[model samples]
Target: MATGRPYQLVVFGASGFTGQFVVEEVARVAAEDELRGSLQWAVAGRSREKLQAVLEKAAKKLGKSELKSEVNIILCDVSDPSSLADMAKQTALVLNCVGPYRFFGEPVVKACVENGTSCIDISGEPQFLEGMYLNYNDKAAEKGAYIIGSCGFDSIPADMGVLYTRSNLKGTLTAVESFLNIKSGSEGSCIHDGTWKSAVYGLADQDNLRKLRRQIGHKPLPVIGRKLKGRGAVFYSNELNQYSVPFMGSDVSVVKRTQRYLHTHLNESPIQYAAYTTVGGIGSVIKLMFAGLLFLMLVKFDFGRKLLIKYPEFFSGGHFTKEGPTEKQMEESSFEMTFFGEGYSTGQDPQQGKPNVKICTQVKGPEAGYVATPIAMVQAAVTLLKDKSSLPKQGGVYSPGAAFSETKLIDRLNKHGIEFSVISKPEA
Candidate 1:
């Protein structure tokens, strides 16, 4: 129950497929004691009709038909700047799900920062994320409003998983080789169009991503220790005994930002980060290589890019089309991320050729795009509201680890299905 404001949280894309989960999550949490006095929230989108339908269905989904009355609906379109400003002024927090963030993400962020309202999104777009930092980070800091991107599965597990490993390490953290594994329990599997479209758009615009990085001014590396190594964007890891390749997503950028933030601002040592996914057996590796090559061409060539835009479903193996994933598909899928790390002993003096320690950790969660995203976003929103004191006093654009503590989010994600646990530790 928010006092001065009518709502504690407002979901801006409540009618979209991912937005429904966010709406439902807010409703479900409202039924519990999480709502301080009364559940005060609103679902927003361009269309009132769709928002109404989602609000009504969300009540049923929560198993509390009467909860519909407690929930409210508001309409705002990303296309209109004033409308976004108005919405930003009403709520203390906004969970934005509408994306290919590079296209539709900035205005809402601008509104929130200007209004001094904190914002969170499940964005995996590097260009958009880096742009926010370059354009809005200072203004948001002036306003004391934190704009945290990649709150969802895209980088949460990656960023937080590294934090978990480092926290448990008795050594100076040096390197993290992260791996992504996906599994589904239902009859069929699809990555959902929202996630797919984000990937394709990001692929086609790699140069912009690099340009943004330079504009953002790459953070200085440690002066006297092992600097991060970029052996290749994609490579195989012998430690994991699996053919690993670059994640080809925002996970790497997000993870690195978190590390950079810590190094620059918190005086923590910078640690190198590498991200990958398992390709299963030999046959699947060949298929993955073909798919990888196809994706490279799609992004590198205008002709191939046009085909992707026109017939995404055909290229996406029917996983992405005009419609998004069904509730069943979202429900039946899950993902896991494992971290293999090496570093020097924490108490020992820095040395060049000696990374004598190793540690293992993993984060387990439900379907990344759907099931886990809502929980991650809501938890972040609630934590910002509840734990504002412990957070960075001067707000700015930040990665998850830099903005919030491992304990604050790790505890919340653990309560849900997204959990972080240490798998192994170096000897004493």
Candidate 2:
């Protein structure tokens, strides 16, 4: 499908904390035998000095002489559309690591969509992404650009995991429940200016709930309409035996989209799904109490808002170090997810099957953000660049499993140190 010379893959926000990691990933992939000539990539950010410093460090760390020589830098500001448009020019793909995307990402995505440059971001913010879906999906579809978000650790693995399990199911899948278990080496901190920006935007906006509703209105069904149906004001499931919180973002959107894409594009089985953070025992009680207090405080008192601002560190990005789980530790770290599904088939007598799949993947590392994110981001980009024909033509936004095949993505991920496998399955 690509008729031009080698595509230019640009990493925007290349000097930021995660941006540097992405650059290293780009270099690592470039050193690989298969993907060597498929991309002409560079890192772009506002500060040339910071960008150069990162490039120098990356060259040293990667032990690649040609890295410094071959990589180029482009100066683009998220606030400036003309600058973004210029940055988008001649580039077939843009990997955006500049976040919290609600504030700074729109211009970059707008530029990419208008220019027909495929774009991906490591945004975990659901409201912002939902806004994009509502506002730009049509334009992006028209332009033939794939403007995907949450390409990072927040949702990709879990989203893809569910997709893989669903593909293995026999009959129509009525529902899916996913659980994520993360064991990390450190209590993560978010210190970057981008994190601060996202915090400020989230704090300043009182209408996020309303915005979320509007955004959901534009998203595909099973995603937009599915609510956790139960009797109590809050219900607990004994399977996980935890109080669930609304997974506040694109995780639900991405998962639902994956299911929708499979049904529409691949003719796979249709299913309903929900994602939630698992909190158990005393932790659940604490969270529930905290939630109640916060709800009452926000609804009843300006003093509560003031109290929250006073503890901005709790809310802002500076609380966590860029230090991530080491490779050896990540190797020891493990991840698990369980899917609950029910199937019914029309027969002489109706049959009911309660089939559940549980999968656990372990790799060498700490928190997923540091190592896993870079691998996933770069591999997704590589998958996009190398396997263009397999992707959908109208690429406004897509999940990993929906956008690319599980085998292709899993192979690419395995090359970058993350080993994944399904642990259990529903009986045929």
Candidate 3:
């Protein structure tokens, strides 16, 4: 269906905060491929003026003045089905950046599936993602459209990070526990209110998500070894010498979805997984506890959720803002996720006692929300474009690990700045 498409990719929502960075990342890749000149992409949204401004800003920042005139603009809105269908028809794939996806994502997914154009989004909302799969997977598969979510910092680093760890291990990798450490260079870090809004709504709809899971009716994968133990809400991590808490993102859900897909379709052994993020100190932990308690209390009602959305900075301790972080702050921030895996050595029996082998791997990159996200998303798009044959035989909704596990996605990410490597040799 993608043969001789006018454009290979289209950046939908190109005028949004994160969308602009995606445009810049695509421009960077375009500049690097100046000699080949095969990367054809455009910016898309409801406002041509905003899209043009995005291009101009990216051009000025990248020192590529041609970008303003070179990249095309397509006017489309999630509310208008015809416009979305038109936009989907013009491209082989769409990189969706418009988020709080629970509200705006499905229309684009429907359009892409109807048009047989694959789509990917950096959504961290599990309800939206799982809902899309439950509703559209069969239709998308029939139409040859791949709809994958959480391609950004939310889960890619964790999902694909697990894949990297398993592949590097010398034996059957049974369990993986990932610890995320985010560092701010003197400038400090902040996230946009869009992420905050998404979280607010995702939490408020937890009951619906639970109901949707029952509708999906997927059977559980068999346990291969000792089940990974869950940690307390707050705990101390000797691994990084920092106070830690279970990561409140979509990583665990996304990774489990990928593991389920692999185990069911490919008959692969499933790896137990747990995810955590480091909190700075005892003071930070106390603050986090207070904020978390308040957040949970507020997310249960309409008025409370509204308040949470209206004053994101106040609630998040200035970690999230409507204006977002400055370029300097983004440049100064970075993240690393370390994966520690335990499994049995080769030729070991499945029912054996005390699995002996252990290995460690890490994925590190620039500022998680804005910087590394665009890089991972654009690289995933490029990989989908260049390695179609390596993807699933038929397109459908999938997680990042399920969709790009067989492709050179990790290698492409490495060349583009997100590094994945083994940090320690296997030990018995």
Candidate 4:
């Protein structure tokens, strides 16, 4: 056991549903030989009772006798800056599970950035994330704080996957296409009320709607673009044949901003990219129809607004438990991304033929959220801890792919059991 001064890893909102899983993951890893001696962690939430319950469950899962005497519990409310500051002061790193972040995240982030503590969250709200980036990126950089958003299954795989593929291609990448196909065996309700909260926020703000439209238009190809011309809707690629829909949140802007940052700060590649949910046949048609209806409702009546408020559970309750999918079921759930790049070759002169590269990677199923998220986040936290010297010295807000290289991230994720591979083709 590698025991020493434990690195304090605090989980905020530990009493919440997702927060509990995060706490359990930290406990599980801490019990392992590689992580045992060096782990000193605490769980925080507004309710001390709920936080204690979470800690108890985690301790029990680790076989109480074999683990440490007890994990610490901290009560920190997002609404209280003083409490948040105190919590930040204690932890070297913080994993924020509080969401509908447009409302609750800024203060927590402010506390961490000012305290020089690194922070990560599962927020998938674009406007909130972009707002954070605009407001905090500079201050964070000045204070040496690494504030990373969307540290979950929503965008990490795709964002980091693009970085991985680009690493293999020596020259600038002109474009990239990414897709996510998820099938989880363990199903209770994974949807979070956060989605409804965000939708309501967007609906209330006319400026937000305009900003989103402008952002979408800025892309060479929209996040959800029409299926490439005429391969026919019948099995055009291993991914999907029909037009894909915008993943509808931060995945769009995060991926785009990531590629933009890579081009600006690191590679100067100026890559064009888009991300979407791949659907085909009746599934694709149904999705399109639903989207159309939703759009019309938003445009004409207040149908969308009423539905969001009245049916919060319809979008917010599906969460996967550890017992969700069996090993075999996990093997069946997978994700894939195809990179379409047009740029000059790396080795030969600029005159060499423009090589168009198409690369793809697939992982087994149901593992998307359960197995992948915890690993990605933990690895991201570790990277923030271990590679502090090389990272953006002054931190505000950043995406993993933009701020960190794929080599370190992919290596860490792979070691933790996430598989990554690639495929390529010559342009016609």
Best by TM-score: 3
Model 1 lDDT tens row, 1-428: 12277777899988887888888887776666766456577888999889888878876676778756766767799999999988988888888988878889999999999898888999988888989999998999988888999998877888888988888898788888888987766656676667777787787777888887778778566543455465453456666666666787788888888888888778888778878887566776777677677877776777887777677777766757667667787778888899988888867665576677889999988888777888888888878877777788788999898888533888878987788998888678
Q: List the residue pairs that clash in candidate 1.
A: 171-346
Estimate the Cα RMSD of every predicted model relative to the unseen true structure. 2.3, 4.7, 1.2, 5.4
**Number of clashing pairs per prediction, in order:** 1, 14, 0, 22
Candidate rank order under TM-score:
3, 1, 4, 2
Q: Estimate each model's TM-score.
A: 0.93, 0.80, 0.98, 0.80
Model 3, range 237-278, lDDT digits (tens) per residue?
Answer: 998899999998999999999999989888889999999999
- Colliding residue pairs in candidate 3: none
All candidates' lDDT scores?
0.80, 0.66, 0.92, 0.65
For 1-428, candidate 2 gives per-residue lDDT tens digits of 12252446899999888899899988988878986665688888899999999999999988887777788888989988898988887588899998878778888889988888888888777667667777787888888888777787766776766655555545444556665545534532233344434434554564774666664563444421223342243446566676555443456667766777777777765566666554456765575667555644553456655544455444322332334334555455544445554443323111233333333222232346656787888888888877777787666766666777544876666666655564554554
lDDT of 3: 0.92
Model 1's TM-score against the true structure: 0.93
Show the lowest summed lDDT stretch of 10 residues, model 3. Answer: 30-39
Deviation in Å, model 2, residue 280 alpha carbon: 5.4
Model 4 has a clash total of 22
Query: Model 4: per-residue lDDT, tens digit, 290-400?
Result: 755664465334666666555655432223222234445545555554444344444543334444344554432226554566666776776766566667545658887
Residue 425 error for model 3, in Å? Answer: 2.4
lDDT of 1 at 123: 94
